[model samples]
Target: MSELRRFLEQLTAAPSAEALWDLHCSKMAEYGFDRIIYGFSHYMSETSMGDPEDFILLTNHDPSYMELFIGNGLYRDAPMVRWALHNVGACSWRFLWDEMARGALTEREKQIIAINQRHNVTAGYSISFKAITSRSKGAIALTAREGMTQAEADEIWAEHGSDIVLMNNVAHLKIVTLPHQSTGRSLTKRQREALEWVGDGKTTQDIAMLMGLTSATVEKHLRLARESLSVETTAQAVLKAAFQNQMFIVDGIQG
Candidate 1:
């Protein structure tokens, strides 16, 4: 009966990522963070962020700012992002300033700091969720509204850091359940179930038994899944489906 539980119920009911993100932005705004960028990569490794198209990046910053930050590769040099990549949990931006004070930041990181300052994104914290796998990373950058000082933002975090972290964590957990739709990529009900079973390490015979179908029908579904996902093999199809957050979706039941 708590307000937080009701909000979470609404969040989990949001049928689309866009709808959920709007709710998130509003909630964070109530807590002094007026801007946020949340990005998730399910297929990243040390070598690459994987395909640019597979990333689930949601933000409420000005279009021009995002255009420059992502289009110009400024995120590569963002100190908060770097910190999140290496560590988990929330931390205030004071650490970035501390790094700057100690003369440890690279020129690129300093430039990003200046950009953030100019754009009224001068104070906030970054919370990086624990990596569920070596190949996945998800994090959020929350920027305090204009006029809030670093000290004030730090004070807010000191008082409410655990609450903020819990909310963002719930947001991420709800996000992976919503379907991701993209150009020329979608899976049928059967295709999704087949891929889910494969990702669960089931063979064609196992999937057929579970789905009450012949092995040949399961193989057909797997082949179609591979074609729909633009992958070459069943394994690749399963990985691609998971990366796109398409497998194990609720109500994936076939008609």
Candidate 2:
């Protein structure tokens, strides 16, 4: 069997988000993209990508770079990020260079470029996945190793861009199917059970009887789920949990 086929099979069967990410990172590294940043949101809007806490973010970029780029909100002004938000398919970094050469970048965008250059994140490509929902968006940036020029990255893309986009699309689809809760947003088993029941249109009393708990206990679990998800209502909790793939999960695959 071909190596790509083997990798796709492994990717399809990956048991957890972390395992899928590890496989993807190694594969991209072989194509000269040693640093990667992937982000997806199911709750995007006209003005926002929803709360940062709710995003499914995977990256192997340096923590310091990520801190300022994402943590500090510099990505909002990043030229590539703006392009990813507005377009789909693979884009070469030369697009950014061209924009800079034409003096079209805003001051904030220039600052983002400056930081990226300092961290050797100068050469790469971005792939914007087709949105699965009207409000959903997903994109990834693949950064070449230090010292590689945009010309070199473009050459690699010219040869392997189609395969790289296919692999990333598959990985993104698999990741969305897996649970991806943030640290403080994880629900207890009971909370998850309660929310799943709620998603199935169960009343509090019905969930209590099904789970062998009192109605008040079920209510408490449902309440805690809302709190954990930082949502206001039980229905919202159910929706959020489902969005994160954290409800009705298979027993062994709970990650």
Candidate 3:
């Protein structure tokens, strides 16, 4: 077996969230990628559930891209952001060029892509995951400079897909280990219903009609779901709820 495969097997056997994060970082290093960032938007704040924002950020990029990413709000317009919004499982940096060619690029997004190109960041891949309870919707991004081939990308994806899933699962396990005072309360029935609907790919209007409630009421429930889960968006809320088994799976369609 490859070293990365062995690491993943060990991670699967591990009993702790920290151990999983450690294994993930080690595997990313083995892949020859210059940077790996795993971010959970829902768990960015409110650590009642054991700090879900705890991340493993590995990078050899010049500090300049880091500065621009944070200082200039490039993250808001990043192609990764768009991918997350659309719930894409995996994507390449080349998609950014395709988006630009299609005239779908915003000025800020174009600028960030340009900066990355100038910095020799030839390509990257991002994988998003459903959030665990007390956590946020999450994504793991691996970036590399020139010479990263499609075969290499496919190898990383096949090798590390389970690791990404386990990362969020272990994070939730950590929350379950926390004291009652540290962990937040469970979801309400209405919140659960809304989450199930969202996980089924039902829009707010669709859910409202199904439940005999106004769309605004459905929106309110979703908003509460997001706040209670410490997630910033509805999609994150659905992801987290599904991870916790508080929401049911229907049609195999995730929110």
Candidate 4:
């Protein structure tokens, strides 16, 4: 079978966000994109991309670069990031140079450019996935390995850009289907079970009977689940857990 066929099969069957990301990074590396950063947000607004804790972030970029770019919120002013927010296709890094030539880059954007230059993140492509909802956005940046010039990167893209975009779109689709566990947002097994039952329309008494616990104990579990999910009610917890793909998931079955 062809390499792309094998990759598609593996990606379709990938059971977790981390495993899917690992497979995608390896495949992109074969095409000379050695470093990648992907971000998605379901809580995006007109002015913000929602809470940082709610974002699904994956990357293989340098730790220091990520600390300033993502951690310090430099991505808000990044030229490619702005492009990704508005467009739904692949873009070459040459666009940044054109913007610079036209004196279009702002001071903060210049600072971000300097950071990328210092880190040798000079040549690359950005792909913005088609948004499925009004408040949803997803994008990925593929950085060429150090020493590869923009011209060479563009050459490779001219040949295999379609395949790369297709693979990334598939990967992004599969990623959202898999579970996303963010910090301070993970529920325990019992907590998840309670939420799942609530999602299935079970009452406190019904869950207590099903789990062989007292009604008070079941209530405690539900309360804790709401806290873990940072919601005020069990109904909201169920919806949030389902959104994160954490409700009713079979943990080891996918492994």
Residue 193 of model 4 has an lDDT of 89
- What is the C-alpha lDDT profile of model 2 across 86-173, one tens digit per residue? 9999999999989989999998899889988888889999999999999999999999999999999999998989999999999988
Q: In order, what lDDT does every prediction score?
A: 0.85, 0.90, 0.61, 0.89
Report the C-alpha displacement of residue 59, candidate 3, in angstroms: 5.7
Whole-model lDDT, candidate 3? 0.61
Minimal lDDT window, size 10, model 4? 246-255
User: What digit string (tens of lDDT, one per residue) describes model 3 on residues 59-148?
Assistant: 344678766764465665687766865573666656776888999988877887787777666566776655443345556677763677
**Top lDDT: which candidate number?**
2
Candidate 1 off by > 4 Å? 182-184, 188-234, 248-255
Candidate 2 segments exceeding 4 Å error: none
- Quote each prediction's TM-score: 0.80, 0.97, 0.50, 0.92
Of the two candidates 1 and 2, the one with more favorable TM-score, higher being better, is 2
Q: Flag clash pairs in model 3.
A: 42-231
Ranking by lDDT: 2, 4, 1, 3
What is the C-alpha local distance difference test score of candidate 4? Answer: 0.89
Candidate 3 least-lDDT 10 residues: 175-184
Clashes of each: 0, 0, 1, 0
Q: Which residue pairs clash within candidate 2?
A: none
Shift of residue 128 alpha carbon in model 4, Å: 0.5
